[model samples]
Target chain A: MHGECCFESEVLAAVVECRWPERVESELRVHASGCAICADVALLAVALREDREVLKSIAAPPESGRVWWMAQLRARREAEKAASRPITAAQVFGAAATAWFAGACFGASSDWFRSEFVRLASGAESAGIGVFLTSGVGLLLLLAAVSIIILVPAAVWLAVGKD
Target chain B: MFRDATLRDAIAAALAPADSESGSLVESQDVRADFAMDEDSFRSFYDRTARGLWAYLARVTGDRQAADDLLQDAFYRFLRAGTEYESEAHRRNSLYRIATNLARDARRRSVVRPDAVVSGEDIERVAGADSAGSLDLNADVERAMSRLRPNERAMLWLAYAEGEPHVEIADRLGLKVGSLKPLLFRARRKLAGLLRGKDSDHAR
Candidate 1:
């Protein structure tokens, strides 16, 4: 029984590691001839290992692969048309300009800056330096707006028409 | 676990076929089934697995944003795939494999792009406050996982965390089971070494 128990201990290690083979089973049978305890331990260990695996199997959650794959497929589908459409220099330029315009608009509309602009405009009539600076800024703004209204559309048309 | 029968029934009901005059569209039904996953299942699954997937992807790409995108992408794919498994274990193994592939593909497509949006500090902060297990252990695991090659990490995590059998893992990974034993041993040794390093660093 002692010898059989020792043999079962050895088999238990192999079984835990999932390395059990036919030879190990045959060897176990030979050892079990003398040791019933060893035989019982061997059987118990196998059952325990099987139970452990079953519990592990049960505890595991579902795979998210199909979900991940679906996302990949969806991304591919969404990207397909856009990917086929070449990114043009005009698109880059337009994006940059749009960003700049938006930033400028945000800056202009900000309360802090709007208050400062009002203060400067109000003080311009009283201060000679303010008057010249304000009018100079006003004229520049008008010129810029007019230039953008004309040249901007023309450039956009040129860029678009090129393609 | 049985006490959660109500939630399971909810999921089952959500997965149940809808009656229609037109021939039932399995494809559409499958897509809608995710909604039936109940808040509990979705939250539990996301909480338990999403972070692991994210951490794994971040380690692979060394980018937090990329990991986040991939994580979301992975979940979205899972929702759309209509994959059915006989058991949750099979489902999880499949999910990890898919996530690994997605991360690999993303890495291949853009080497220069940032893969993860969140910084390591942010991840640590979130993990630290988490009540699940010790943050240190999770951190160590993440650092250890970071050191492995993509496939090695995937194999180890699936084996250790998911406790999948070699055959199931091999099937999921499209590898022969015979080829996995030695590879798994080596990967585990490497991960153990990495984890030890993390522990040592933390100790200091």
Candidate 2:
């Protein structure tokens, strides 16, 4: 009986690890035929095997698209938030250029600037320097507006896309 | 013998009364019609196995969020692989193979970050009444899983948890069945050692 108990324990370990050999199975059957104690141990091992299989079925993870989708949405939001933080040096440079153009446009309309502009324009034969300044300022303003239109969308798209 | 007869009858009845109007039935029919028809077969297979797949993923990753992402990615790749399955086992084996690869990829991508923290709520949902008692067990399992090479963990889990035959495991994992025995033994020993440690800690 003691030997049977020991053998049964070893079988339990082997079976649990899925290493039970064909010889072990034959030995177990032989032991079970002669000894009731071994038979009981064999039954217990079988029960444990059955229980493990049942536990496996019970432990299986649930599948819900809703849960998975929520996870994906959370990951995507994190990626976007990470992407949206402080602008890089390139972006800062772009923003600085836009701000300078706006400042230049405002400066162009100033009275002191206008008087200096008229004096400079008087040197040019047909059209004053004011015409040159006005056209130049207009072109800068148009360039800034076009940049704002193109860049904001591009930045937003870059931030949200790819992931 | 009687039970086997009953089961066979039950299966036949289940398959016999298929509704033509049902989308799942239509999909199943489409899959059965063509060996080369990959999309419908994959979709049907995913629908059937997603829960089991997620369970395996959650157990492996120990993080519900990571498992969720990995599960979707795994299914996406399975659809793309477009392999014709000869049997139900083949289909399932393919799914697990894809999932294993996805988990490995995710692990490589985020080596520095801590694995997803499994919340108490997640534990309750997965472990149910044994949630409190199994916490240590779950932690031990996860730790053991982390110690294993990704493929080893994948092999051990599919073999033990899924009860896959060695041949199927070999087919799915692309390893010789004989080569897997020693590796599987080592993995199990590692897990058993971890569990023993956890048990001792609880005793203390």
lDDT of 1 by residue, B1-204 (tens): 233455446544543443242133234334345442434555566656665566555555656567657777667666555666666676666667777778888878884264323334443334223322344444445455556777786666555544456787787677898788677657655665565454533211
- Sorted into a CAPRI-style docking class, model 1 comes out as incorrect
Misplaced by over 4 Å in model 1 are A1-163, B1-49, B111-144, B197-204
Predicted candidate 1 versus true structure: per-residue lDDT over A3-62, tens digit per residue: 213464465465556655454667665765455444433333343233223222222233
Cα deviation at A84, candidate 1, in Å, is 13
User: What's the C-alpha lDDT at position B172 in model 2?
Assistant: 78
Which 10 consecutive positions of candidate 1 chain A have the poorest summed lDDT? A51-60
Over 4 Å off, model 2? A1-128, A133-163, B1-44, B111-119, B122-136, B200-204
The local lDDT score (0 to 100) that residue A104 gets in candidate 1 is: 86
Model 2 lDDT tens row, A1-163: 0122446455445555655534466776566446544443333333323323333444433333332333333333343344444434445556556667656765775675566456555745567544654676544544665766787557645544534
